[model samples]
Target: MALNFEPELPTFVFERTYTNDHQFLFAFPNEKKMPNARQIQLRRLYDIMNLSVQRNDLPRARRAWSILARCKEINWKAMWRLGITLLGNDARVMESNPRKIDYLRTMLLQLPEERERILAELVQHYILAGKYRDALDELEFYLPSFPYRDNPVLHVYAGLLCIFVAQPPESAGVNEVEETAFDSNSLSRAQIFLEHAKALDPHNIVASEFLHKLHSISQGPASISFASHDSEDETHTKGCQPSQPKRKRSNS
Candidate 1:
């Protein structure tokens, strides 16, 4: 009888076993169980891009990012920060490549969630690149919109840019009527923006200082020297220095 009967197997012993990876896949069926060819390629490119950036190999990083940007599966909107970093890696290089600005503008359209922040950054970049008119235009275009209209910092930037463009060039010969009209319009706009900024954030130092300067400018040439005012304004608005003469304060 002992020879004829075999020992009963336990129920657990008969159950199929799954590894951790299998369990994970089972838990998240909607997720990809394994990387497809495209995903694998993208992952490799991402690694290369990050490593190249870390190594300061901008060319290599740009190449990798370019590929990733073109891929259909890639969510470039989510990766906009990385794109900004790559595009702005070299300030000198970026100055020559206007396409980078265009690319940022394109991203601005694609990333609605980050629109305000991106627009602010884009305006700052334009200011740094000595494109005062362009920066002001950008602010004007967005200032009527939802979030930008309410943003105090953006109002300050707009106000500063207005003051900048209002200044008449020292060497340029132009029609007196046109110059006067332009200056009048710009100063008016600057006052409006600065007042708006002050109203939005009363504690904003930049807005308050600029408002005072604007008021002093209105009081006539004798009340405030343009050279001194310009220098003081530039000091308050960091990274937005206009391409103007940096004159020393006259000691009389």
Candidate 2:
């Protein structure tokens, strides 16, 4: 009995190697490997882009952004805001390069969530560039949609642009009949937009003021100066969202 009391020694012992890579039996092939060199580079580039933007180093940010945009793994649609900022941040550059507007227009389609906001910015840019017709066209194109249909500010913008375009040209060669017809159509469109704006936002002073101007125009020959209302519109836009700061005023 005493001789049989010796316990049998275990043949094998389980020990985990701390340095060994552990792979789960059900892990996917992609999950088992570390990030590829390209992935790491792309991640670094994103960091660079953000850092450069914060520092106001637009050129550097743009460089990084360009590279990142070309990467197949990067989702440019979600990154549209960054692209817009890079392309439109510099007032002089934007003014000199009309291509920036085209870029913004293209990017507008890619971002559904931010489409309304981006469209607003695009319209403002067009106004600043003295492209009143283009701005009105853009507003017309989008304002018929669901959320855009309800945007009071956009309606106001459209209304203002319409009034501006409706002004009779100083050129004497212009046919009176055609000019009258054009003005009539434009003023009608402007009236509708301004009324829609007022209906949407009863407290929108811009719409109220413009509507008054429209009424005066109908009574007699009246001059409604859009230049004076630019600052007012911008002020209201800023007040609408106190948390979000508006873009810098372009020197151009």
Candidate 3:
């Protein structure tokens, strides 16, 4: 004879336990993790860019381009589109706010494949901002990467920057001896770069002109006067956007 087991245990006890377990699993999904975070981000980037272009909103475009640039892995086509948008935005930034030059540099570094082309634009931006020293530093950093053996134009810019950095603004009240020493060192450095530029390309008319002017300034008057090195940027394309391909979002 079996004892009355049904009365001892509640029939709904197992049902209650199952409900609690379901709630716990829903609250903390340990077994099933969310997927396609990158794809989702990329989709958002596309949407932002598309809307920005339709609205002709530069600020929005810039924000989206920056986000894409910072992404660790982006498709080649997406990266190219981002670079083009940023290139246009950077030109405006250079004209309005020169201090954002560092941010522009960071954006350029994000797209490694387009580094040379973007770096050339960056150098021009620095020149336009009256930052000769900064421009020279960038030019020197990338000079070795240039396809040519030596960039005579880059050398000319570097030499000009050296002269600018050496020449003290008239306001700094320094003794004649100190001024002479500082100017001498700067002139020596400038001479080295200019000479190298001439050696690289004897027919470089700009280098030749710079050297002639430098010599004239040196001999005619002990007073050092600087010339403007702000060069025009021909790479800037206003109101331009790269065509983006249709990309599918992962549904995983």
User: Which candidate tops lDDT?
Assistant: 1
Query: Residue 149 in candidate 2 has what lDDT?
Result: 99
lDDT string for model 1 (146-236, tens) is: 8889999899889987876776554445453233433677789999999999999999988888888878777662334233454433433
**lDDT per residue, candidate 2, 1-252, as tens digits?**
444332222222112332334322221212324654444444456666777887778898887777666656667776665676687566234341366578778868777788888888788766556565667777887788778999999999888777766665534244552334337787899999999999999999888988897887776633433434555443222211111222333344
Model 1: residues with Cα > 4 Å off, grouped in runs: 1-45, 70-74, 88-96, 172-182, 222-252
- Model 1 earns a TM-score of 0.65
RMSD of each: 16.1, 17.4, 19.0
- Clashing residue pairs in candidate 3 (N, C-alpha, C atoms within 3 angstroms): none
Q: What lDDT is reached at residue 194 by model 2?
A: 91
lDDT of each: 0.66, 0.64, 0.53
Off by over 4 Å in 3: 1-56, 62-100, 107-113, 128-131, 140-149, 172-182, 228-252
Error of 1 at 14 (Å): 38
Per model, state how many residue pairs clash.
0, 0, 0
The numbered model that scores best in TM-score is 1
My TM-score estimates for the predictions, one after another, are 0.65, 0.62, 0.49
Winner on TM-score (2 vs 3): 2
User: How many residue pairs in model 2 have overlapping backbones?
Assistant: 0
